[model samples]
Target: MSISFKKLIEPDSDLASVISQWENDPSIIPLTRPNQNQEELDHREEVTVEELMKRMEHHQIYLIYLDDQLVGEMNYMVDPSHLYKKETGTAWIGITIGEPVGRGKGVGYKAIQFLENEIKKQGLNRIELGVFEFNQTAHKLYSKMGYKEIGRIDQFTYWQGKMWTDIRMEKYFGSANNN
Candidate 1:
């Protein structure tokens, strides 16, 4: 299976809708974003396509494709100098294999590898991400990808019935490139 990433077009309602759906997906929401508070729950703002289009302004979004099938989405904050100059930079990133077709098939693993290589070539020296304490699978994936835990928040997010911690992890390019 050939995996690829295509840059998402700006203000793409169709694609944005798909991404919105993923963000709200039961399987993905807890893993990617579990910090919503009780008050926010009552007034929870949905990730509408319009809101996603607005976010696309500052965040670089990419659609992860497994051959011809769209399986997930990944994103990172845009760094203007990271791509144009050889300046060292650190970028936090997110990935979600929202589609069932991509889960349990190593798509997230491969997607991270591809994005890391792409950013390394663009002058980024470090990458960081936060994994919820309850998500052991993601913690393991990040660990196996050479991301070392740097810190943690004791009571980071309230999900399910209680609060869970968030572990911060980072990987420097020197070792990451060799992964």
Candidate 2:
């Protein structure tokens, strides 16, 4: 399955649904929401969509669509720290496909493919992502896409009276000479 990249807009029903599903997903919530209230779901969703719109206006976010449907979303941003400011043009990415049928298929891979193309198009040399330790499914996908775990934070989140780690992965775009 091919994935299309688009900008997310406010008042988009599909984006709303995706946000709702993501809120309820155990894997995503553990990382995105640590000690948040249940009532904050709707508010968080609204704010996130709004922020995505603002970032899109700045060329920092990209929404993923599968066959014209809003199945997932991803984005890239410049590395904030000065450590990677020299050689590595780091950009972050996040994705969540609400469709069950879209999970096992090649949709996620296609999204990553589009992400790579989009990052390179924006003149970025590397794409980075932070995945929760328990999100093995996403880890597999990123590994298959040539992403390597460059670092990991231990006990990054203390939520629900439990601790979890976040794995940071990075993928270099294009060959050595190009970057």
Candidate 3:
């Protein structure tokens, strides 16, 4: 399954629907955040298409496609308050595979690899991400992709009658590309 990305520009109905579904998907949300019930998720603040467009002005957001079919989305930004203070070209990234068919198919790995190359070309030296402790799948994937655990936030989230930490992982440009 070949993976590719296109910069997210204007929001369309299809994309909006996909985002809404992903936001409300219990299975998907737990992978990124504390496991919350549908009611709580429904009441959370929603990002309108206009808000997303505004965010695009300052971030690199892309739509992930597999064989020309939209499968997910990924985004990154240089954090002004990053520990490296942007001097080392430190950037944080997030990704979501909205389509169930795209999960566990190496689509995310390919997409991240592609985006890493793009970031390298742009002179970024480090890429980082935060994964919930319960997200073992993502932890394994990131480790396989050469990201090392740099830190963690204690009790970052509460869910399922327990507290979960957030694992911070990072990979530097020119490091071993294990994938």
Candidate 4:
């Protein structure tokens, strides 16, 4: 099925409610949360819609649709590190297929393709994202899509009987590795 994107606004559209529900979802919590310290386990906490909007002021979220049905979401923001330095434009992206029916399909590939095209149109030459090391599935997906590892946050969490890290990956429009 073909996919499309629609701009997301909080506390207004019903589609926004889907995102609110995901904030505390057990499956989603593990995938999205990051523990910066071993002693502090952050479930990422649930936030009110207004709070979410405020916190995400610099970012934009788009509802992902498949045949007019909401399947997931796409989020992108100007890389904070690149805000003042404009030599090379960069954007960080996040994609989630919240609906179970959308998982194990090519939705992620399509979503990244669509998001990348949109980012390029906005004049960004670089795109980056972070994947938990334990989330090998997502890591492989990004790798398959041309995202190469730049570095990692290293050994912040222990999961599944092992210590895992946050892998930072990037895809640049021109000569990423050299850049």
Q: What is the lDDT for 109 in model 3?
A: 91
Candidate 4 accuracy as lDDT: 0.74
**Comparing 1 and 2 on TM-score, the stronger one:** 1
Residue pairs whose backbone atoms clash in candidate 4: none
Ranking by TM-score: 3, 1, 4, 2
Candidate 2, residue 21: CA error in Å?
5.6
- Model 3 pairs in collision: none
Write down the lDDT that model 2 would get.
0.66
Q: How much is the lDDT of residue 22 in candidate 2?
A: 66
> lDDT per prediction?
0.76, 0.66, 0.77, 0.74
Judged by TM-score relative to the true structure, which candidate is superior, 2 or 3?
A: 3
Task: Give the top-scoring candidate (TM-score).
Answer: 3
The root-mean-square deviation over C-alpha atoms between each candidate and the true structure, in angstroms, is 4.7, 4.2, 3.5, 3.4
- Candidate 1 local accuracy as lDDT? 0.76
Residue-by-residue lDDT tens digits, candidate 2, 75-106: 55676452222346767776667666566778
Off by over 4 Å in 2: 9-27, 31-45, 48-50, 57-59, 81-88, 158-161, 175-179
Better lDDT candidate (1, 2): 1
> Which tens-of-lDDT digit does each residue in 1-179 have in candidate 1?
87888877764667767776777676677777756565432333456677877778877778898877999988876444423222347777889998898887888998898778777877778787889999998899999989888778777777777788889887877754433
lDDT tens digits by residue: candidate 4, 135-163: 88899999998888887777756555456
Candidate 2 Cα RMSD after full superposition onto the native fold (Å): 4.2
How high is the lDDT of residue 140 in model 2? Answer: 89
Instruction: Say what the RMSD of model 4 is.
Output: 3.4
TM-score of each: 0.83, 0.73, 0.85, 0.82
Error of 2 at 17 (Å): 6.4
